[model samples]
Target: MRMPQGKPGRRAAVPPWLRARHPDPVQDDPRICPDQTRGQLGLFPTPPRQFARTHAARISDRTVPGFEAVREELRKMADERQIRARTIWLWRLEGIARLALAARDPDREQVAPQALKDLLYSGPILGQALHRAGLLAPTASHRLVPPRGTGPTRQGGQRDLDLRGQCAHCLAWANDRRVLCAACTSWGYHIRKHGGGEAECNRCRRTLMVSDGMCRMCRIIVAETEVDTARIAMDYGDQLWFARPHAAGLAVGPRTSGTAAARGRFAHKRRLARARAADELQPSEHVLNPAQLELFPAPTRDWSRLNTATPPALTTAAADLVADFFAYMRGRGWNINFFRGSIRTLRILTGHLGADAPIRECDIRALVSTGIHVQGARLINYLRLRGLLEAQPPRDLSVARARRSASTISSPAFAAAVHTFIDVLLGQGSTPSRPRSSKTIENYVATVLDTIETWIAQGLGDPREVTKKHIEDALKPLHGDQARRLHTALRSLFRALKRERLVFRDPARSISLPSNRPVPAGLPSDRVAGLLDRIDDPRERLMVAFVAIYALLPGQLVQLQRTDFDRSKGRLRLRRAGRMDHIVYLDEFTLRLAAAWELHRHHRWPDSSNPHLFVNRNTAVDETGPPISTAAVTLLFQRVGLPAGRLRIDRIVDEAHHSADPLRLIELFGLSTASATGYVLSAHPDRKPGPIAP
Candidate 1:
């Protein structure tokens, strides 16, 4: 090759004639033209592409404002030995310049450093550099006039100076002019200079210093150290922290005095107080804080102040009632911590109704209309208990909820018929030998409400308009218990309505449910032997035996009383509503279980006044003598891994298998004739039904 160019590494220059003929070469086609052979072979060739070279812009000619100022400041910093000549130093200066340009002020010559706060990749380092270059203006006056020096104020020590001083590192206006900024003083300094460095901690022996004597790990343990309060009290020979001396259970220590000893003793006492205050109320006894005992024996000063300091607008009678209600709650051992909401609600009610008038359900209803129904319910209950209520005691909560379902009916006539049926069922206007329970009324209304709404939707608004066709159509989609309940509810509703003359006809009278009851089946042979072994709770074990052995229903089991047990006779009297009471003979196993449960209840809840045979921790404390709920009895079965109803049915069926007599099953388990017959058939499928018991 000939000489390349003037320089060894440079390209050779082209002649003027050659350059004129070829100017600049245009970009070539990326793909090669396909030949016949290539096409047949499915080959497509691509040629290399020519990419234009890009030149990087020079930093000196960057569009950022104040870039020259940044460079000069960096040079000054280097001269002053503030920063070294490193690539990072140049990058930092450029970053400062870019941030300063973006945060530049249009109204003034300099931008406030606060303007640079939120920009991308911006920080105090960039702002500090720009501030040192005189690009940022100080808007905040130095203490409004003369700048404060880096020293303590008269009131506070270093905190005052730190607040007044502007930090050079942060570029804040709070730094003092005479000395370095308090915060920035440590920015470039070693921790050793400030009495902090890696040294072995005294407690943990770790090479990380937190304080003069401890590392961070050891310091946390020291802060959270637990002390023996009883030892401190015994050492001091002062007032007892515990109610009983034995309760403290701490050894005496030598007594000490001095400021440090006083502080340690005070801390121990505070910890003890907090621990005692946090102890929860025991199930058998009330373990209230010592300070809260005053609330039980008598009202505290604050309570007395509230009682006597009634507003002038409130009547004397209303104020007395409010005081009595609070006293009643206090007597019931209610914690006073929950009294704030009730106090506010009662105050609002008594203040508005005026002391001149007695608070009545009508007045409470007016408040309820204004959206305070929860408070109204409380007020109504209080009035009823005080015998101040004139209206009948509020109906069962279930009945109210069931009535709400009837309110959704589109037709007023059908809705009224349903409500009247519910009222009659609850013994509101019509009296029957045995009034239906709230739950029974609720169930009846729930089953028929959907059918009533369906009839309304099908253009039969009146119950009189409901014919056999309507009842049949509604019953088409329902089956099993749902179908049976619907049929029973319809027949009862129309029959009651016809008696009341609300409906002229009874269409559901002839609609019959399946007379055949489902046969009761026993549990598997493998599970029966070990079912009672799994229940460890004395109460649960007793309950399981009642359900699994005696075949007692959950409802009857929950209603059992201590008097009903008849321990002398070894018999349990199950007094269920709507059915004659039945006496169950307890075998030796069940009697022993019952005795153990009674002993457990007596020991666990000795102070309890509840008379129920199976008193739980919750019901034991209640003075109303309400027995443990059916849900509690069901939970006992669940804990044993078998359903209560299934266990009871299994017991009845097993009994039937042994006897195969319907009459014995009925008298033994208090089951109806149909139920007894079903169990008998389930036990022995070839057995015929016995005569129905009258």
Candidate 2:
């Protein structure tokens, strides 16, 4: 019954009972060293020096310099878990040994935690065992806690591997009963796969990780190739649907670029698809109808709404009012999509308010203010538009403050004078024939403000302190149109001040503005040609054409409505603010572009109540919305790398070159006498007027 003990530095002898139990222990288990022995009961084996020396020797030859401690840690893990010696040897050779050799830190005694986890990811049982035995750090184990009813040594663990139920594809929380999140499911397949951490991408010729010789971007492109190619094919089927009338008679030039042509046709198809799917003209199930209320399905659970402690119910009267509002919207030609969104928001709002309470604007604002119902703005709009809520909401004071803060003038007297000057420009007595436009008033105010701010900075406080020298000094730095504008603004400001007795003299009156106009220069012909060729958007193409070909200003462009075009006569009657209407006879190119844009507009918004020729998604929903803003039109021109003003000037100057008659320019473009004469002088320098006879 005694344990076997070997001589110092020598092997232990096998006991008689152990030898009888297994006469060929080494042959039966290769992991059993020949010099080791078991106890009399054949349970725990006796410690032997040869066993440690042999194991250490095997690991020392294979592992890095300082990671010999890993072998001892592995032995401890195997012993604590009662793992079979053969299994321990297999784990060492297969997993742990590889990790030790792969250690990036050569001088550290233990392999890095991340290295261990990465090596043991596929085998959770071994990872947990090593973690329990203290060989692997807690964080080093791939699975720190085994699933219920599973042991550290047992296999086939059925634990959910995802982190917080997140999807493997999108990294977003997966919905119940699905592999991918809702957004990922809706977007279809777009997963990017990266392979081994080394290799060059075949497509982009960049050094990056690749799967099947394709980088992530290249793989994405490949996955989307089918969809893109199909869309392109669809575009090609309808090439001449908006072709110019005279295109057949003209000598053919190079075909439109593939990118440009595909863009235009695809845009048309997309608009058509939207119109078909809008369901505005289709018979819709009006769930808001009182008769259908009994059959309507309950809305699905919204987590945001569930955050409320006690959600209220919709009152009978309030529900009826909301139903009436929906009906009013329907009568006004709003699409079902607007109805669907409004209903969801209204439902949230009604639940936030009590069952007995009527819906009120102040109450809705309170709910939004307290963050209880953030989606109540659209609901408010619906109620207000239906006339059930007539009173308008209070304006945002913060916006008013921000606007006021833009005027940073310091001197009180000078600021008052500037304010008075603005009032005079907007006075009731101003004639309608020469009324100042908002832009012109803004420019006048801006010029006066700048001059006053400069005077204040120079320690002059009163408008009376400004002199002829000050006016001349201000006009010194500015030249061309800027100088003329400054001179005009100063003269007007001083005249108003002198008339009001706020100043003694009008210093700017004697200083005459230079009348020389700068010669107009056109953008490069090649650049213009390239821009026109690349213009793929129907609306933008038309906008640019109006500026480049017909010389329409941005102000005139935004004023155009659907009524301006004369379809039968092929003419566009451009109505000016204060001048006679200038008629443009549409050529084959402009006509086709106009037709395409009209078709696009019709299909994109079949139920749109907007009357403007250019309507976007925002304006299309409202019945009485204004045309596209001046900023939006300017942005359109900017995107095409051409200024609208430059285009207009170039077109005007080009027209003048064809005919030097000022009257012709005036009649054709509705230009004033001075503007027409300036263009004529610029185009035909030989026709310059002789010196005036005294």
Candidate 3:
């Protein structure tokens, strides 16, 4: 025998060659000489294959009963299985087979008795309790046992029966005859019947039926789930499923009630309604803060002196409230400064309830008057909070009016006189009910006379009795030019009177008086250079320069002259420039231009005033200005011979051809579209201004 070699550390395994060669003294003929036999057999046969030989012999021995009979017995066994499969199975003793099928394969309950037991149970298609928990019971073959970690197991625990399975009471006595599982103890049947029984419905897996039936929509959407007619294997609910809210009600309670989900719909609806207008108006702080200055009413008196006086002291809370209100309005894109809306509310409040809005209500009417849209809704909100908004409308204001009649104006003469002149002044019967200045009154008188004469020829002498139809007739004969002017007057008056009780109730209560517009001011040419030369103030010189480069009015330039400039950042602002108080931005050229002029001029402005750059000095002589009159500005333009009549109306006073070519300049500066560019159309000393793009 050959000894195996091994290292000192490891004892070597014995080689197979050394163990047994069967002592073949010689390499016996490759198969006993290919055909040689021992004794009476012609074949030496292959070396015994022990297990195979044993099985074959047993198979052959069984044939002694008679080959055909053995075959018949095998057939009988197979036929018996087939017969058992044909009939419906009624469960009997709970065994490993039954329990395993119940766990790993739910459909096994309805399958043929002989359908491959383990295959049917462990099949991918037949799913039972679908969860992290594993099989109900281990199968007869230990290999078929389900993986662990299902619900706590008790079948093989210490006690005869555990809390998870059969309990002590289930036996009734010490070791009573039977040991049943918890399911069998609780109900006569196993959990297979009590469980949801595949209770999922396509319409609502979350829903359960009150009487243990399908949910309402489920019944409508899922039909005929019998196995034979798997004809209707469904992935989802049928088409045309019932709608929500109503559909949600169906899930109320198959076995338990849940009405909260249904109630949630109403809450969601209310939330949506309140938030619908949240995105309506939102303005940035930078834009609104500077612009709101224009929103303040032109003070009842010249506040030029008032500006020097200290503003009224605000209470800390009042100040904070005002700050926040300004912040809030700016956030909503409003360039509002005065409590115009709030004070109007104050006015109304003072009118009603004697002196103020309920302190608790804090007023909203002011916001509305300022062109903000939220006040009506805000008023409604507070009233609701106060438990008053939802209350029925109060008995008509007429009752209140009757009670207050003593204060009512008794003479019709004042109102009537104003009414009779309405047609002549407004070119119609009524104008907006707005307060007017002496200038507005004069304009009104001039326009009224014109309208009356024109109407008289068309047969309308008195506008007091003029109905809408009659006014239209009177308006028909006027040219578009005249009609447009009349419309403007009417529109202006109506907007102003919207809040007045008389105006709200009567369309005719509008103001017939014309607008007392401040005659737009500008400096004259002969006066402008003279005025500029006289001003020694560097600040005012810078201010004049800005007015020239950017068309800003005097007051507008004054308010915007402080820390906002950043020479490095390249931005300049015309803080507030219009009735709307629009904030205007300028590029770096502005800063450099102002700096250059200041260094060269060596002038200084009033020491007591704000860092504001401008101050008018010689206006009393002709127009009250450090420079010149509004009249002077216009006359200067006329002398220069640029298109004067139209540009003045548009407020675009300065013009230079950005492109040198006349036609190109006209096109680039937007001259073709409106009156603003008309300068390019006129013959110019030079072709135009700047280099053309093309």
What does candidate 3's lDDT look like per residue over 1-694, in tens digits?
A: 3345664556566567765754424322232212222222111112211122222222221212122332333344435556564222211111222322222222222322222243333322222221112322333322221122222434765432222221222211112123433322433333245553334443345333221444433432332221112233344333332223334433322322232233444456435544553333232222212223455533222222321111233333334434554564454343355334543332232222221122223233332444452234323332444333223333433323322331232334323433433322334434543333333444543443444455445654333333445445545676555765665554443333333222433233442334343322333545444434554545544554455545555435445554555456655544432223333445565675567654543332222223433323222111112333345444444544432333332233334333324444333222334333344333243543568635
Q: Report the C-alpha lDDT of model 2 over 418-483, residue by residue, as the tens digit.
A: 666655665522332244665666667766667778888998988988888988898899888888
lDDT of each: 0.61, 0.59, 0.35
Q: How do the residues 1-694 of candidate 1 rate in per-residue lDDT, one tens digit apiece?
A: 3666567766567888888998663322212111122112111111122111111112223354566786677666666766655566666556445545533434345655455544335445556667887877786633311232434455545345333433322223444552444433443254567767667555434444345465443332333333333332343242222233332542322433321223655577656755664353122121122233243432211222232222224346556767887886676565546654455556555554433333455645544454421245445655655665534354568889888988988898888888888877766746463468788888898888777766666777677777898889888888887888888888888888987788778888877766665666788988778877787888888888888888778887778888899877999888866678888998999999988998987776665677778877557755446677778777767766788888888888889989989999988888889778888888898666468934
Stretches of candidate 1 off by over 4 Å are 1-392, 429-433, 576-580, 603-605, 616-618, 635-639, 661-667, 672-674, 686-694
Q: Please give the lDDT score at residue 322 for candidate 1.
A: 74
Q: What is the lDDT for 61 in model 3?
A: 19
Candidate that beats the other on lDDT, 2 or 3, i.e. the better one: 2
TM-score against native, each model: 0.49, 0.49, 0.24
What's model 3's TM-score?
0.24
Candidates in descending lDDT order:
1, 2, 3
Misplaced by over 4 Å in model 2 are 1-312, 317-381, 389-408, 428-435, 480-482, 498-501, 689-694
In model 2, where is the ten-residue run with the lowest total lDDT? 39-48
Clashing pairs in 2: none
